[model samples]
Target: MKALSYLNKYLVKYKWYLIWGTVFTAISNLFGIFPAQLVRYALDLVRETLDTYHLYDGSTLQPALYSIFAFSLLLFAGGTLALALLKGFFLFLVRQTLIVMSRHIEYDLKNEIYDHYQTLPLSFYRQHNTGDLMARISEDVSKVRMYVGPSIMYGVNLIVLFILVITYMVSINARLSAYVLLPLPILSVLIYLVNNIIIRKSEEIQASLSKMSTYVQEAFSGIRVLKAFVQEQQSAARFEVESDTYRAKSLSLTKVDSLFFPIVAILVGLSNILVVYIGGQEIIAGRLTPGNITEFILYVNMLTWPVMALGWTTSQTQRAAASQARINEFLNIKTNIVSKKDINRSIQGEIDFRNVRFVYPDSGIVALHNFSMHVKAGETVAILGTTGSGKTTLANLLTRMYDVSSGEIRIDNTPIVDYNLTSLRSQMGYVPQDVFLFSETISNNVRFGRPDLPQARVEQAVRDADLYQNVIDFPEGFDTAVGERGVTLSGGQKQRLSIARAIARDPRILILDDCLSAVDTNTENIILNNLRRIMADRTSVIISHRVSSAKLADYIIMLDEGTIVEEGTQAELMARNGAFRELYEKQLQTEEV
Candidate 1:
């Protein structure tokens, strides 16, 4: 019922076609009953002649026999042709309309889901697997489409056919119809019970399938690691477990299907027996005309399809219901982040955090607490921190990935939340710790941040990021394809491309979050020098563990356990002999040795 409600909007549009299709079905059934009446009438005429051979005129039977034969032949031929045409036309229109509606619904749902995903906090992705989310968007949404297209239409057709058949039967002979329909109520009850089981089992099956999809995606994505570590056998075994679970659930569903069909057959057979036995008795007792009896039997036969269809419809409806529930659940998940409608008028590069605190939605421990920072416009500041010292958390706060649980963050004298998200993000260029590239050409990847920039400008940015020579070395130059996640490129090349993307944006605030770590000292120095010259007027935040990188900044802040323990110039911090000095001394010793 709930699933049907989801499809009501489309159903309303095509209801007229359904009504006419059903009328044609009823007309076909009526014409089908005539042949049986002819048979019974011929049998009666023969019996009459046998009783009075001498008195009966053989000529009198000819016209009646001829009329019966002609009427049956014409009705059967015409009705069959008309039914075929009607069914074809109706089914064609309905299927095409459903396809269109499904496509439109899919478009709307995908856009809505994607838009919601964009607004959701980073914490959501941290807890959820990429494969599972992809499955929901692609596979689960497809299930909803299937339900809307075929399942809803067929289910409604079955119900309408059943009601029409039952109404015709009751009008012909109420008692006989009641006796034949005894099994129908029982069948309905049985279907109800099966539907409950099917829904539960279908949900379990879909869940297992999702897990299988996730496992396959993960294994294939990490195939290189599995082979390098000789974990191929282990990976195969794990995949087999997930696959076997999927097969088991499918088999269980089939078992339920096996039981369903047999029960439906039995109930239909019982209905046939009641119609034949009771209607035959009426003929013997002369209480009913033979033609009438034959018509009743024909009606019973015509009704078998609708009865069978009822059972099949029940199964499809249950599966669709389960799918709808899953789809709706995903659609209903609210995004943790919300953007304001108004844009901040003056968004200078100045950024300030006043005792801001944050914890991941699923975690109890706070990632950042009482973290205060102030940066003036056009200042190149370096943040030095150990692993898990809240450096990334601080960067995320600047972008409002997770809103502060307490205190506030302000940008250009306006609260961060006051600015529209698009406007706020446009003012900043962020390079993440991990550089991700699309499987596209080199030029496309470089120009990703500012797609509308002139080609010459993109070439200049590529040169500034120290990647122009690398790009030219490829046979296809800028047109060379970067494989998935830039797998074709070396680590340093990927990092350099990421830097080029950020530099192309030309944002007011440029943030490089340890983006230079993959490159060697010489390449890093070249890139840093280029960035310093290009981004001299921009407010820059450089996050790194290396003191050499920190030394390039105007001022340095050393973070420890989510707190700023030391803040000074590089020379002053080294003189004080704190965490930065200790890290610098260790690197110097490694270099000397």
Candidate 2:
């Protein structure tokens, strides 16, 4: 019910279509029932004509038999045929409107989920898997579409047809109608029991499918690791376990369905039997005509398939209910990184952190503690830190990727949270260690943030990142494809492309989070020289473990266990012989520089 209410917000625009479609459905069902009523009329006509007052008794003209029977019978046949064709036309319109509405709803719901995902903090993603999320957005949402469309259409249709058929049957002979409906209470009890089991089984099947999807996604994403370790057999065995679980759950749901349909068939069959016996007795007692019995029998036969459809509708509704719950889970999550209300300030290069602290959710480990820093506009600051020393966490906090646990961060002397999220991030060009490039031409990747960037600016950023020579060497030059995640490029080439993308943004603050590590000394030097000119009038924060990179900073801060333990020029830090000096010595030895 909650899911239905949530989805209803998307349906307000389609109310007209839903209303008209329902009207057409009721009209079509009436057309379908018209022929059955004709059967009753025709049967009565034949009986009356052959009665003691008619042709067989010579009380009526023989010519009246041919005229009345031929004209009435032939006319009803053509009328019934015409009505059936008209019903088909109305059914098409009904489906075109309602089914199309469901499709639109599906499209909107999927995009809504994806947009919500984008707003959610990275922490949420850490707790969820890609494949499970994919299952919810794709398969689960599709199931809900079925509930809104065909199931509702058929369910309403059956109701209209059933009411008309049962009402007319009672008018023919109320006692026979009552008897035919006797097994109904029992069928109702069976549906209640069977529906509960089907709902439970549907939840299980969807869950198993999501888990299996997650396993398959992970296996392929890490296939290189599996082959390197010769773990193909192990991976396949694990996948087999998931597949078997999915199969078992599906068959269990099928088993519930298997029991359900037969019960419905038997109940419908019982209704036919009651009509046959009780209705036959009414004819002999002369309380009812043979036409009424025959008509009642046709009505029961017409009802059989709808009784079967009841079970199907029940199963689909239950499955759709289960799917709705899964989709709602994602839709209802409160965002952890929402932008501050009424705040949309532009950024300048100056940045400050005042006694800030941060801890990862679900992990007790503190990433930052009482961290304070101040950087003036138009200055370059280098952060040297060991692994897990809160360098990346600090950068993330500045961007409001995850808000600070305590204290505050400021940009341009204003609180960081005082700016709009999009506006705040737009001020800085951040290139992280892992560069993810889309499968597109070199020019497109470079101008990702600004699709309308002029060609000259893009080429200039490429030259600044020391990648122009490489880009031009390719046969297609700037148009060459990068493949998935830039797989076609070497590590250094990928990093240079990342730098080019950042440089193209031309923001007030530039952050390179160890982005130069993959490049060799000469290439790194050339990139740094280019960045030096770009950072001359903007604030730049360089996070690296390299002593060579740190030496060029106006000032350097070395982090140890989430605290700034050393702050000085590179020469001063080396002279003090602290952890920063030790790191510089080790890197120098490794590179033999």
Candidate 3:
């Protein structure tokens, strides 16, 4: 219940809907009670009329009395029919206000969660998986909506109906009313016990749902790997295990839920029996009439739905509370990465890293240890490093994807954190080692950073990356669809397309992170020739292990572990005959072979 209290702000936001809905519920129930009272009045009127007719058995007045009684009964029936129609209209209004407001809240809540997800740091993604995140936003929010819409609606309807029906019953006959309501306390106790089980089971079900979603999502995303390894049967068996767990928990909850209606039905049946038996005894004592017995029976039937719905409303509320608590877990997390200032200053591409030390939070492995470098404006610096030598960490740190652990990085002599986060990233283009492209047309993927870019610019970027000829050969040319993650493209083609995307941004600072590794030497040489011309005035950092890739750089740094081992121009490092020279000789022999 306390977890459900989080929705109070949303209720306040749409308070007018709640107010109008409550008013309509009360009016409908008031009208609903009137038909039972009308039945009572008509029954009593008939009895009195019958007695009067007997007294005037052979008189002229008897004809007039009979006509009057027929007209009176017709009026009673018409009045009851009219009240019923009005009640139906107001009930329509109740749903219109409350249910529609719940939909609006659902829309707002989903957008809020999505926007928060975008703000979370890269580390946050590593800590949590994609499927659980999706479950919280989609499935969990839907459960909360059940409480907002139907539970609230029915709960209010029950409360209002009970007050009106019970007060009228007691006013007519206190002892009979007591007997009719004798099962209520027992119903309350049953609901209390059942709701605890419902909420606990609901939490377990939601957790299992998240696990199942994660497994399916991962399986689909890595279908290629599964096929390559011939693990189809194994994957299917794993999925079945998850599915069975979810199904078992669901069946357990259903078994408990099945008890609700029957319990309500038996209790409601008992109340009806009590009303008839006690009212008939009162009549025999001359304290009540046949009309009274009929009226009490009608009221008991009128109370049937609300009492039955109580169990359903409580079940929905318990599930909602369980779901909301899960939603709150993510919402409450405060992201560590946020812009320190709102400044959006232009960058001159003078980058500097000073005594930087960083350790991965999750793995506790030091990725960079006292690493320092400086790149002058319009200069190209190549970093040569083997795997695990921390080449990619430089790009991540400069982009502020993760902040520095100890020392600082700066662009144009200002701390990277001082610039607006969006502005800083916009001025730089990065091509990652592992290329990724959306499921869109080639042209769209190329110019993803600038959707409004002209066709001429898009074609020029593709041509510069040496992918123009291949793209134009396709049937649809630039309009051809690249399947998820560019699965339609070969490995070299995907890398070239990623390069085209980065170049299309026309960034002042470009980071090419082993992006050309998949391409052949001839294509790599041609793309590098184009880049040398295109990047003549912009600063660039080329990270690679091949000495051929470092030939055009103004300076080269060879790294071992997380620290720089050699720093010089190509000729200078080769002349030293150290680690750089050894690697270059090995690659030269491999190229020849």
Candidate 4:
């Protein structure tokens, strides 16, 4: 209930729906109860006709009396039918108001969750998996919708029926009503005990489901790798384990849920027994009529559904509570990176890393240590590094993907945080080492940064990235769909397409992070030559290991273990007997061999 309290706002938002649904439920129950009374009247009339026949035995008026009795029974039946139709109409209205409201709420809640996911920091994604996040938004939200729709509607119906039915029973005979209700308290206790178990089991099932979904998603994403390694059997076995755990937890919850109907049925049967036994005794003592006993039984029967639904409503509420708690966990997380000031200033790409130090929050790895550098606007500086070196970290910091742990980064002589976050990132074209293209056409992928670009611009950017000839060779050319993560394209083509995407943006600053590693040396040279022309005016940072890529830059810096080991012009670095020169000679030797 405490976790579900988060939905109080939405409840208030759609308060009118709830109010009207409640009204319709009450009206429908009122009409439903009257049919039982009509049955009682019909039975009483039959008994009265019997007495009258005895009084007027052997009279010629017997035929006329029978005609009158027939007419009276028809009136009672018509009244009962009318009341039933009216009850059904209001029940329809109840569903319209309540169930429809739940669908609307479901839409709003999913949007809120997805919007929140967008605002969450990168670290949040590092901590949580996609399947768990998706499960909360999709499966968990569906469970909550059950509570909001059917559970709520049925619960209201139950309350109204119980109040009206019990009131009528008591009005007729308080003692008999008391007897009929005796088993109800025991039923309530049982529901409470069973529901506690249900909530626990439901939570376990949801967790297991998340784990299973994650495993399946990863397996599909890595299907190629799995088959290449001939580990399909092992992967399937692991999936089976997860699936079995999910099945076990679901069965455990169902077993607890299964107790609900039987418990209600048994208690309701007990109430019916008490009503008959006690009401019969009263009739024998001349304190009650057959009609009174029948009416009491009808009232007990009317309460049966509501009593049974008590268990169902409570079960749904508990499940909703568990799910809402998971949702609230993500909603409560505040992103650390946000624009301090909403100022969109023009940046000329003069970047300054003033003693910048950064540690990965998830891994506690110091990716950069007291890194300091300055690049004037329109300058191209190539960053050289080994695999674990801090090359990509520099690009991440410049783009504000993760803020520096200590010290500061400034662009255009102002603190990066001072600029509007969106405007800041919008102006910089960043191509990561790991390329990712959407499952969209190649033309759309290249124009992703600036969607309104004309085809001429897109083609020119492709030419600049040394990918024009390859794209033209394809049957669909620019319109060809790059399947998930550009899996349809070769690794080199994907990298080249990524480069073309960055080039199409015409950004004030461009940071290419080892984007040329997949291409051959000949192709890399052609792309670097094209890049040098495009990057003449715009500030550029090229991160790579190969000396060929670094030679395009006016200045070069080599890093080892997060610290710069060498920095100089290519000619000056070649003159020195340093790490940079050693790497250059080794790479030259490899090419020669």
Candidate 5:
């Protein structure tokens, strides 16, 4: 019961289901116990040789010996059959009510974990592996259900059966009842000791499983790289290590479990032996009748089931406790990114960065240093930078993906954090350098940002991405399924679809981070042509390495080592031989080749 407290909230919600199931369970066990009483009456009737027997109505039932035996046998058979069916009916109710509730609770818990996973800060995902998270949600959730369902059912049934059976046994004969139950308390102590070991070993086993899952998931995700590098054998050898660890920990848990049931069998067997041995002595001394001894034996048989079940239920309980602790590890993490209350400010896309600074927590390196910039509500500002030059970092700050370590970023004169997170993010469109598409239809992917947008808008966005030619080539047109992470599509197609998604949002501000790098100048021109109308009334920040995109911008800024080295209209920067001009010349020379 103490171990079950980890799921206390869920238990409380389904308390009515549990109570009804217990009621049915009580009825089932109560019906099953009456057979022992019938056996007693039969044994005593045999002892009296049909001379002292009476009917259930307290009237004399004297008759010929063979006639009495036949009638008694018939009555016993009919009563037992009726009781069996009644017990079966209640057992069905128990399963439907309690087991079904456990399943529902499992779904609730898993969904709650997944929803929390979505709200967690991106840094939390960086620190945790996919396999570990998967194991917690799938494997751990199942174990918690096991504890509440089978463990609770068997555990409560054992207790309730014991109270009813023992009270009846006492009414028959107190001394014999005490003698038969003497070994039970000691057996309980043995179960406790074994369960302690089981809990410890189960925790270790679950951890090893998580590690193995992580290894398998990551290894397969990089299978293409492994094959390309001809490292198949090396990868297999690494997997062998994880598999071996998992197997070894599972065996250790099994080793502890092996000691439990046999000890319970031996102790319970002793109770039966003591019951028969002492009752036989009393019968021979003429103090107890043959009928009493026979009934006691039947009662002892009933006791064995609950005694054995106690060992199983306790072990199951310990396993659930171990899994619950692992799940809590994820649930207890504080959500790193949280919003303030009553923030309903709408953004109009005038952006400002005033002396902003940020250091990546994982690497402890400053990606941006005192970066300051301003863009009017409807200006096109192209950003130029070498690798590691903080272009993408600036875009991230404007969206408040990560709060700046120092200074402030503002949209329409309000701090980025002052507006509602959902409203602020929905107003801006962002296409990252690394594009990710779900395993969904091309049109569905394009419609992701605004699902309610019309199909005409989806086609328009796809045209703006210069994907019209590619869409017509595929047999499925917009309905084609992109494989996992859009692996079935070419890199350029994926980037175009990402652009289509952002474009369909009709954002107030659009940030494209080197989004047109994979396409040729002809397609880039087509994209630029389509985006001109969209960018005319919205703030656009285009990060590009190509001179074609830069020359079309109203202003371009060159970033070198997290600082602004040059900023002006493209023609002005090209007039002076600056970093931007040098990049422009290099791209022109490369294209001439």
Candidate 6:
């Protein structure tokens, strides 16, 4: 129920529809009660043996009966029509509002989560599953919609129907009404207990469902790997296990559901029996009339639905509450990295790291300790390191993906935090090791970084990346769809297109984090030569494991563990006979063999 509060803001906007819906429901119930009362009155008229009765003469029984029937029919028609119109309109309003609110909330939550993801350090993503995040955004948000739409209307209708039916019953006969209501307190207690159980079970069900979705998503995405390893049967067996767990959970819920309705029916049946026994005795003793007993029976019958609805609605409420809590947990996660309050500056990519130290949030080992580095406006600096040597971490910190735990990083002499995130990130271009492309044409993918760029400029960037020849070689050339994540393209082609996309931005600083790993040494050298010519006056940071790649840079910095162990030109480091020399000699020997 606490999760329901998220909808209060939207509900308030459409309160009028809810009010009208409730009002019409009450009117319908009122008219619905008339049919029973009409029967009772006709019975009384016959018992009185009035051949002719009028209001004034007490003698025109035929006209009276005709009038009663006609008037009851009219009320029934009108009430039915009103209830239909109200129900239709109310459901329409609720659906429309829910759709609109779902869209808005989904948009807001997705944007917030995506923005948070961008700000979070790389380690966060390393520890989390991509499929789980996708499920939260797609499947979990849908659960929130169910809670807001049908569940809410049913819940409210249950309450209104209960009050209306109970009031009518008490007005007709107080003592008889008490007998029918005696079982309610016990029923309520049982509902409360069941609600707690349902909440816990429903949460477990949702969690299992999320896990199942994750497994399916991962298996599908990595079907290539699974088949490559010939693990199809093993994968199927694992899927069977997950499916069986889900089925078992669903059966458990069905068991609870089966018991729930029967218990409610039994309670209602007991109330009906009590009403009939006591009310029949009263009539026999002449303490109550036949018409009164009939009316009491009718009211007792009407109480059954509200009771059953109470149970059903309680179950839905518990499920909705659990969903809301999960959604809130995701929505409430605070991003560790956030833009400064007074972010009003732009960046020009003169970056400096002063005595900086950083440790991954989930790990104790520091990735960078007392690290100091400076890159002038137009110099190309290359970072050479082993796989875990903090090269990528340094690149990530430059983009503010993670904040320094101590000291500071300044962009253009201003603390990186003080510059607006969008403005700062827009000024830099980053080509990651793994390139990702949308399922779009090559031209569109290249233009993604700068949508408004002129066609000529786009073509220029493609040629500059040395990808133009490859694009032209394709049957459809630039219009060929890249397929999912650029699956249609080879590794080198994807890397080249990614470079083209980055170059399209015309950024002040370009960071290539091993972006050319898939390209052969010959192709790499060609791209590096082009980069040197095109970005001669623009700052660049190239990260690489190959000594050949680092040889093209004006300065090379070698990182070990988290700190820079050697810094100089290729000639200078080789002459010094340090770690760089050892790596260079080993690579030379491997190449010779």
TM-scores of the candidates in the order shown? 0.89, 0.95, 0.96, 0.97, 0.93, 0.88
Question: Per-residue lDDT for 376-399 in model 6, tens only?
Answer: 888888999999888988888988
Query: What ranges in model 5 sit over 4 Å off?
Result: 1-6, 50-65
| lDDT tens readout by residue for model 2, 1-593 | 56666778767878877888888888888888788778778888877765723535443566666677789889878988999998999999899888888888889889999898899987888789999899999999999998888787778777887898888888778899999988878987888899999888999999999999999998887777889999999999999999999999999899889887799889888988898899889989998877777878888887887778888887898899999999888888988676566477666689898999998885767998899989999888999887888888877787678888899998888887778888778778988867889999999998997899998999999999999999999999999999988978998999999989988989888888888889898888888888889988888899887767765589899998899999988788889999888988898898885
Q: How do the residues 1-593 of candidate 4 rate in per-residue lDDT, one tens digit apiece?
A: 89888888888999999999999999999999898888988998999998997788889988889899999999999999999999999999999999998998899899999999998878889899989999999999998888889989998898888888888888888888898999988988998899889888888988998999888889988888999999999999999999999998888888889999998998899988998899999999888889888888888888888888889899999999899999999999989888887779778999899998999999899999899989999999999999999999999899998999999999999988888988988899999999999999999999999999999999999999998999989999999999999989999999999999998989999999999999999999999999889999999999998888987798898998899888989989989989998999999999888
- The better-scoring model by lDDT among 1 and 4 is 4
Return the TM-score for candidate 5, rounded to 2 decimals: 0.93
Residue 186 shift from truth in candidate 1, angstroms: 0.6
What lDDT does the true structure give each of the candidates? Answer: 0.77, 0.85, 0.92, 0.91, 0.84, 0.77
lDDT of 3: 0.92
TM value for model 2? 0.95
The model with the greater lDDT, 2 or 6, is 2
Model 4's TM-score against the true structure: 0.97
Pairs that clash in candidate 2: none
Residues 1-593 of candidate 1: C-alpha lDDT, one tens digit per residue: 67547656645665554455445444444444445545555556655544554454566876676566566556656655665566566556655554565666767667777887776778888887776778777777777766665555565556555576677667767878888888878988988888788888988988887788888888877777878999989888998998899899989988887777788788878877887788788768776666666666666676676667666667767776776676667667777566665674546698888998887677866877688888888888999888888888878888778889898998887788888887788778888888899999988987787788888988988898899999999999999999988989998999889988888878888888988889888888898888888668888899987777875698898888788899988889889988888988997787677
lDDT of 5 at 328: 82
TM-score for candidate 3, residues paired by index: 0.96
Error of 3 at 362 (Å): 1.7
lDDT of 3 by residue, 1-593 (tens): 89888889999999999999999999999989998889989999999999999999999999999999999999999999999999999999999998998898899889989998998888889889899999999999999999999899999999998889889988999999999999999999998999899989999999999999999999998999999999999999999999999999999999999999999999999988897899889999988888888988888888788888889889988998999999998888878777787679888899999999988887788998898999998999999999999998888888888988989898999888888988989889899998999999999998898999999999999999999999999999999999999999999999999999998989989999999899888999999999998789899999998888887799998888889899999899889999999999999999999
Misplaced by over 4 Å in model 2 are: 50-64
